[model samples]
Target: MKGISILGATGSIGTQTLDVVRNSNDDFKLIGVTANSSVDKMKEIIKEFNPKYIGMMDADSAIKIKEFCLENNFKVQVYSGMEGLIKISTLDEIDIVVTSVVGMIGLKPTIAAIEAKKDIALANKETLVVAGELVMRKAREEGVRILPVDSEHGAIFQALQGNEIKDLKKIILTASGGPFRGKSKDFIKNVTLEEALNHPNWSMGSKITIDSATLMNKGLEVIEAHWLFDCNYESIQVLVHPQSIIHSMVEYRDASIIAQIGSPDMRLPIQYALNYPKRKEKVAKEIDFYEITSLTFEKPDIDTFKCLRLAFDAGKKGGLMPTVLNGANEVAVSLFLNKKIKFLDIADIIEDAMTIFEEYTHNDITIDNIIELDEKVRKYVINKKG
Candidate 1:
């Protein structure tokens, strides 16, 4: 049995990861879990999984979880904040660390797990987006496997099996184009949060949903695929596919394209990460070619979704630029979600931060440097229009 620690045990991917673990019959075991502040959800997960350790990024939430565990005679170690996340990630029993937490917060714990020689099941693309060079190097040094847990990356992983990486031409990542696909900039400016959050294909967290609408999520994935597959940013392409069945495709130098097609379910990738180099009984739904009629593709409107363009620029620059871009986008998206800023302002804020942080694009790629830059960019974006 593989022992795993879930870093964001209460979020969309985290909860679904737990579902995957629960459904498995002794093939996987939960050793640790973490949450930001969802004490109720954390408590339910603890009750169900009985993980040995839990980290609550919010100190107050950790206190509540501790109280509940103590009152119920539940034996579990509960820690709080960033330090807690790192500690649990390095736990001895956890052979696999499922870094599912969104944003750059997952970066540090992922480094911790890699340093501990724990294989990573990476759902948090922001980890690679911000510090791909540093993170991938650390994984290599530690001799730890960094498996892709995102559907697109997982599809590429599956497609590349038994094929030499040297023979690969390019990776084509498919996007659902989100709810705002064909809408022009003028139309998007008037869109509300609910409208942007209404992703047509999959259920995701609010931050990701907003990123999808702006096509910035696809842009970030492009950067991630570059790091995961060790390909050039130019070699990674994105196609706006309305149907998400073809999650992603891999092209060879021989002009052959291999695609991994499946129902739009996150569980497939999550479980595949857990069972690396092995296939298990299916948990999620399979594709029904009979019911599926057509699959259409288009070029994403980078002119309309400037955030996507900004991501490409930052990614191509390749340093602290992507870190600043990810940080700025996070703050901007959070502000838009809270109604503190207009939806279109999200890209504007990111662009501003990118322009300002370009001077530091050559900064050190150390983990500490990345974290410092992430915080600086977030503060810059948060206070720019405040």
Candidate 2:
């Protein structure tokens, strides 16, 4: 059985990952799990999985979990903070590290896991977006496989199997166009948080839902594709497919497109990552082709959703710019969710942060540098807001 460590164990991806693990009990072992402040959910997961180590990024949450476990007479080791996360990432028995942690915080632990010679199932796009060059290079140097857990990248990976890289032309990434797909800029300006959170095709965490609304999620995926596929930014194109049936497509030089279609269930991709070079049976919604008669695609409105443009610029600029962009967006998204800023302010804040930062190219990025950059960007955003 392959031993696995799941980061962000209480979130949507982490919970679904556990479901996949439950389905393949005989094939996989849950060694460790980590979450960020969801004590109740973490407690439930600990009871079910009985992982050897559990971590909470928030110390108070860890304390709450520890007290609850003690009061309930549960025997489980609990840890807190970044060190705890790193400890779990480097666990000896873990063959695979499933990083579902949201935001730029995932970058360091993911690199640590890769350096430890663990295969990575990456759901955190910010990890790749911020440090794709370093992460992908390190994975290559260590001979570690970084599997894509995001549906778009996973679909592209599935389509690229047994295909020659030389024949690949462009990657077509499909987006749900979010809840504000065809709405005018004026309409979007007045969009409330509830409207933005109402994703048509998928159930996801709030940050991601907001990113989807701003088309920043697609932008991050574009950067992620560049790293995962060893392709240029220009070769990656985003298509607004409202149906979300076609996860993503790969176009060959001969003008043929290979696409992967499935129901918008993250479990399928998560399971695919866990069982590489094999397929497994799991409980998820299956697509019925007859009922869905049409699949249409359109260009994203770059005029309105400026986050996509900002991400592309950062991707092209390379180096620490993407890190700044990711960090700023994370802070901005948090602020927007708290109602400190309006929905459109998310992109505005990111763009401002990107402009104010100096891009540095580092051949060797230590965990320290990643943390420093993350803090610097967060502080920059906060100062700008003040």
| Candidate 1 positional error at 283, Å | 0.8
Quantify how close model 2 is to the true structure by its C-alpha RMSD in Å: 1.7
Taking the tens digit of each residue's C-alpha lDDT, what string does model 2 give over 1-386?
Answer: 99999999889999999999998957999999999998889888878878888889999998998898889777878889998888899999899999999987797799899999999999999988878878899999999999999999999999999999888999999999999998888888878888889999999999999999999999999999999999999999999999988999999999999999999999989999889989888557888888998999999998899999999998898877787788889999988888788888889898888877765434245556767887888998888773
As a whole number from 0 to 100, the lDDT of residue 100 in candidate 1 is: 88
* TM-score result, candidate 2: 0.96
- In candidate 2, position 162 carries an lDDT of 93
Angstrom error of the Cα, residue 312, model 1: value is 1.3
Error of 1 at 33 (Å): 0.5
Question: Please, what are the lDDT tens digits per residue for candidate 1 over residues 1-386?
Answer: 88889999899999899889988888988989999999999889878888889899999989999999999988999999999899989999889999989998898888889999999999998999988998899999999999999999999999999999999999999999999899888898989999999999999999999999988899899889888999997888889999999999999999999999998999999989899888888989977889999999999899999887888898888878998889988888899899889888989888888889888879888888888888888878777765
Model 1 CA deviation exceeding 4 Å by range:
none
